[model samples]
Target: MESSLKIGSAQLGPISLAESRYDVVKRLLALLYKAHSFGVKFIVFPELALTTFFPRYWMTNQVDVDRYFETKMPNEVTQPLFDAAKKLGIGFYLGFAELSEEDNRIRRFNTSILVGPDGKIIGKYRKIHLPGHSEKRDDVPFQHLEKRYFEVGNLGFGTWPVFGTRVGMAICNDRRWPETYRVMALRGARVVVLGFNTPTENINHDEPLHLRMFHHRLVMQAAAYQNGMWIVATAKAGYEDGFHLHGGSCIISPTGEIVSQSTTEDDEVIVYDCNLKLGDYILNSVFNFKKHRRIEHYGPITSQTGVDDLIDVSSKL
Candidate 1:
């Protein structure tokens, strides 16, 4: 079952300023066709792939806000995308906003899914770390109201036996957190794939554009090396609704090297043949949890309710 899988990370330019989900799907279909041409078995699309980042603006009406969310996967506009993937016999990861009727009420979440080459749903992940403010920030030029639109994701990080390898899914902000990758790594995930839509400018604070790009690669690279897993990070980049997004979609190795990457901010696919077993050596040696890790001993932080007073380590030394 251990085999080389050709994986692609797509870097997409802005969705139309009008936020057309239909057009987005068309673009995805085009990307799928391109992926097929390259013999890519699996493709990773960016977060909020179905529409422009809608939370960037503030809206009061619930119906108006909910319009951006999909009531069901493979709906009228998106069924063709699923169909194309099936026809091409390629699997993929897609991130989108979800409006689900659960427990007799409508709930919204930032969601993503992993599909098999046969186009069947394999596993799903809801983004747990919802970024930005719930209330509209009028002071800033743009808004990030993810906390207003989405509830906390109920499903914890999960890994699945997929594509003859253990794979996991994460959404935009989730990639920034080390725990997101660590949880899946603990679950025997060989590959942790994620999709993101990150703007070039930080609205909350000032940061150089180049520094933002550096940080994006920095965190994922460290996560891959520390966890001994492959990482595929796809991005919805370039300008969306006047905001410029960073597009550095990449496929990373267990050794924390970027094996493949997107060169353009527009719709681009970068593919690499990933060897799933490459991480075993690191997992069994340096990061072998069962053999060397001692989690029970690190209780000072987990056991405390309030911040612990800083100790003078010099005295102990």
Candidate 2:
């Protein structure tokens, strides 16, 4: 028996600083309905889907930054999206800024959630690999202050058994790291859905514009093949309030092939009927962790964050 499911990447165009949450949710609803029309059973929306990528600007007032983070999911402003998805029998993955109260402290996180067809949140993953700086930088046109706004994700990489197979979730920068996919794959994830709001320019260093898009695809493609899991990546693209985010939203198969991609850097929906069993060949043969992995030799991956003093091997040679 073939286990298959229809999935989609619901990409959004620019959202200005003034767009209300009401209007943003409306746009999301439109895309959701569009995906539903294509017989998509599950859809992935882009990171920071609600508002403009607010981390680009520097703000001293805590209240100003807090405005962009959602105090609760499916709050009054976003309830319509939930209601409509339930009515349409569609499950979805959504990314946003989360304002949470935990252990008597207010903490914010770059977050995403997996909603089941019944419109209930089945799983959640907070973003762990936050990029950019914590301080204000006046040298660049925009700041990448994700570190200033969000705490490192407290939840571990997790996979949920749903949609006839296990599925996982990641957000933005997390997709760039290999560990994100590997951890999920080790936990039995066959398909990983992620969303990103990637700026076209690199604020940290000088790099070609083309490489930004290239690196985006390269990392995800490599992760998919190495882990033998399908990767569905959606982008919040185009110029938002004059800042550009390149969009190359795509769906990659377990073989590292880009099966479907969005052509335009705008609001677009791309769908594919995915065979969940496609990764079995790779996993059972090349990536059988239980049979092939040597955990004793892989300690540095978790033990060390940066390069240590170089050992002098010339003597041995």
Candidate 3:
């Protein structure tokens, strides 16, 4: 299996704000069927995928809030999707809201998991860089309360060996940060799969809707080229609960080229036969880490805990 990976990204259309877990898995199964038809070995889905972007609606009732969180992965409602993937001999990466008991207390996280072709859960990554506010805003039409609902991720960035390539995972907002890709790249990841649910509007600032789409692709492309890894980024897009989400789910090559992308803001599958080893060529050339890296001088880049005026240490060079 030198270069036999047919990777796909599943871009989902809107799931209504009140869709059930059973219904959500049905859409996933449909995508799986489509991928099987295309001979896709692995597929990536969108973040907070099972239901509508519930965080957009602020809630006071605990039961209403907890309804969106899954107490366990592949509980009765989602088990069928895993079974279906195994039956079809396809692996997948899925994103969801996870509710688990840690230290005798229930904790919530925005999470994603990697499933092997055998339907076994391989690895899980909780989203570390949670986006959005922790409370409701009186001025905005809708809320983005990820920070209020989900705790910051606990597991750090990591990669796993499989199919002659190391794979890594990230969630929605994580892709915007360089460290997300670099951390995985440092671990020798040949391909990284991430899922996102981004609203078309920038509530924090007045920005054009087009920039939302551009910025999304820009970061992924930059990450792919800088790290010399394949990137599969999928989205839960379109109008979910009256808010339009960007749906430019795409697959980028090691060269930072858009190999495949979903044009429609709907449930679509885009596949790419990737020769992951192509990334090695870039890694060994201009981006050669061992030959070019100067880590000692980069400490200042990570020293601050919060946004502050940076020291002009680079001027000394």
Q: Can you write out model 2's per-residue Cα lDDT over 177-226, one digit (the tens) per residue?
A: 99999999999999999999999888878888789888999999999998
- The positional error of residue 126 in candidate 2, measured at the CA in angstroms, is 0.7
TM-scores, all candidates, are 0.94, 0.97, 0.96
User: 1-317 in candidate 3: lDDT tens per residue?
Assistant: 25658899998999996777788899999999999999998999999889898889889998899998999887899899999999998999999999999999999999999999999999999999998999789998789999999999999998987655889999988999999999899998889999999888888888897887888899999999999999999999999768988889999998999999999999999999999788888899989999998999778667865557577668788
Best by lDDT, which number?
Answer: 2
Q: lDDT ranking from best to worst?
A: 2, 3, 1
Better of 1 and 2 by lDDT: 2
lDDT of candidate 1? 0.88
lDDT of 1 at 295: 87
Cα lDDT for residue 306, model 3?
53
Candidate 1: stretches off by over 4 Å: 300-317
TM accuracy, model 3: 0.96
> Global lDDT of each model?
0.88, 0.93, 0.90
Q: How well is each residue in 1-317 modelled by candidate 1, as lDDT tens digits?
A: 57678988877889866757778888998998898899889999999898888888899999899888888887899888889898899999999899999999989999998988888888989999999999877789888899999998988999988788999999988888887888899898889999999988799899998899889998999999889889999999888767888998999999999988888899998999999888888988998889997888666644554566544459766
Residue 265 local lDDT, model 1 = 92
Instruction: Mark the regions of model 2 whose C-alpha exceeds 4 Å error after superposition.
Output: 309-317
